[model samples]
Target: MGASLNEIKSKIASTAKTSQITGAMQMVSAAKLQKSENHAKKYQTYASKVKQVTLDLVSHDKGPSKNPMMLKREVKKTGYLVITSDRGLVGGYNANILKSVMSELMKKKNDDAFSVMALGGMGADFFKARDIKVSYELRGLSDQPNFEEVRHIVSEAVKLYQSEEFDELFVCYNHHVNSLTSEVRMEKMLPISFDDVTSTPSLDTFELEPDRDQILDQLLPQYAESLIYGSIVDAKTAEHAAGMTAMQTATDNANSVIHDLTIQFNRARQAAITQEITEIVAGAAAL
Candidate 1:
């Protein structure tokens, strides 16, 4: 009985440690999420404005020239920029994004050859294990990422596009819909489409200096950079939210286990005491 009690005590101690770790992790994730949430919101506003302005330029300009990125090409090759967390314990955050990408890949035509640009450690590993060629990789990014942090990957991806390494490009990441919810999004990157702008009844009028082609030549790259960076910011925010939720659940489960173990321990201790009292009373009676 004593040995069993000691074992339970050890288990309780270990579980308490685990609970503390999880609680601390939850707090950390919450703090990160707070910072990232603000960034994500601001980035979304910036991204929308950039898109609107670019669409306005593309729609109003009556030029004989067009940006190459705006032109559609044959889909012989594809580039996938997959964003995931560098660390685990974020519940299904990474898994959900990966699954979404994989599902899309499975639907592609047999002749399409795709390459991946892995933005985090988990994503790189996931693709590598499946024999998917990762042509570019950037990992160990901060939870609150800035545009410069991902500039190199963006540049290289653009270069790949220019070189015709891939006819089309797509970015896959988790979008932070709310604190409790996120949606996996696969966005087309290359050959920027102005369909939404063209369909809209309203368009912004822009006065271009030194011709529209030169201005557009510079604007298109900035627009692409903003899109990629914005997606990364959104994904980071989602990752933090997911981590906080996962850690909170883990902490709750740990508390429940501790409570159950404490109850069993108490019952065992009470039974042992009752047995000891019975034996002592019987000995006195015998004497």
Candidate 2:
């Protein structure tokens, strides 16, 4: 009885320690999630406004101006930019993105060359270990990433597109649906399409300051860069939400284990007391 009680007590102690750690982690993740969500929400307005301006500029053109980024060519080579987290413990956040991308990649043949831009340690290491072609790797991104942090990577990706390194460019990241839900989304960044925007040209037209071609040459790259930065901002928010949920689940499981262990310990203690009382009564009867 004593041994059983002691064992249950130890289990209770271990479970309690785990609960404390998980609870702390949950709190930390919740705080980060709040900040990340705020940042994402604010940036979303900017991203939408920028998209609207670009759409109006492209759609309202009076001349036959074609942006290089909007041109669609035969798919010869592809560039895949995958965003993941630097650390684990965020449930299936990283796994879902990797798996979704892998499923798509598996459809292609070995001969088709695809360059990978891995943004985060998990993503970089995952592709590297699989012997995949990782062209550029960006790790150690902040929980709430700033545009400056993402600028170089975005510039290089655009440069690769401009140099014809990849005929098509796709970026994959976790899109934040809500605090509790996120979805993996793969969007084509190159060959910018205005499919989502209305094709109807704005009735009011403004004169181009320098000419349509020059404006597109500068504006197209900024639009492409904004796409990457906006995605990263949303992905960071999703990452924090996932982390908070994972840690909360962990804490809840630990608490359940502690509760069960506490009940077992009480039972064992009661049995020990009953055994000692019975022994005393038996000795008295024998005397």
Candidate 3:
């Protein structure tokens, strides 16, 4: 009985320790989520303005400009910029994004039809394991990422698109809905779709320095790079949110286990005490 009680006590102690660790992780992830969410929100304003400017440039054009970024060609190869987390314990965050990307890749008739630019260790490693080609990879990003940190990779991706390495590029990530929910989003990033832009009442006029074509030549690539960076920030926010929720769930489960173990310990202790009293009473009667 004592041994059983000791075992139950040990389980209770271990579960309590686990609960503490998970609780701490939950708090840390929540802090990161807040910062990441703020960064994402702030960047969206800049992204919107950039998009508006780019759209205005395209809309004001006299004729179809010969810019490669704005022209669609035969899509012999497709590129995917897949974003995932470097670390685990974020429940299904990485899994969901990776699975969606994999599903899309599986539909391809040949592996040569698509290439990947992985943005996290989890994504890079996943593609490597499956023998999927990862032409560019960036990992170890901070919880709140800055644009400069990702600019090089973004530039490289844009350069590759310009070089016609891939006819189209898509960014795959988890979109943040709320603290408890996120959804997989695969967004097309390249070929500069003019149809998607609804002309805003705000972008009425612009002062062209040289010409609209020259301005587009400079702005289009920067616009594409900004779009990639914005997606990274948004994905990071979703990652942190997922991490916070996962840790919270883990802490709750650990605490529940601790509670159950504590109950078992108490029952064993009570049983031991009752058995001792009954033994003493029987000894007295025998005497």
Number of the predicted model whose lDDT against the real structure is largest: 3
Model 3 lDDT on a 0 to 1 scale: 0.89
CA lDDT, every model vs. true structure: 0.87, 0.87, 0.89
Tens digits of per-residue lDDT, candidate 3, 1-287, equal: 97898888888888888889999999999999999888888898999889887887777744577788989999999999999999899999999999998999999999899989999999999999988788999989988989888988889889999999899999999999999999999999898887755785343465678887898899999999998898898899999999999999999999888888888888888889999999999999999
Task: Report the C-alpha lDDT of model 1 over 100-150, residue by residue, as the tens digit.
Answer: 888877877753478889999999999889887788899999989888889
Q: What value does the lDDT take at residue 187 in candidate 1? A: 92
Clashes of 1: 0
- Cα miss at 57, model 2 (Å)? 1.4
TM-score of 3: 0.96
TM-scores for all candidates?
0.94, 0.95, 0.96
| Order of candidate numbers by TM-score, starting with the best | 3, 2, 1
Which has the better lDDT: candidate 2, or candidate 3? Answer: 3
Which regions of candidate 2 fall more than 4 Å away from where they truly are? 62-64, 199-203
Model 1: residue 236 alpha-carbon error in angstroms: 0.2
Best by TM-score: 3
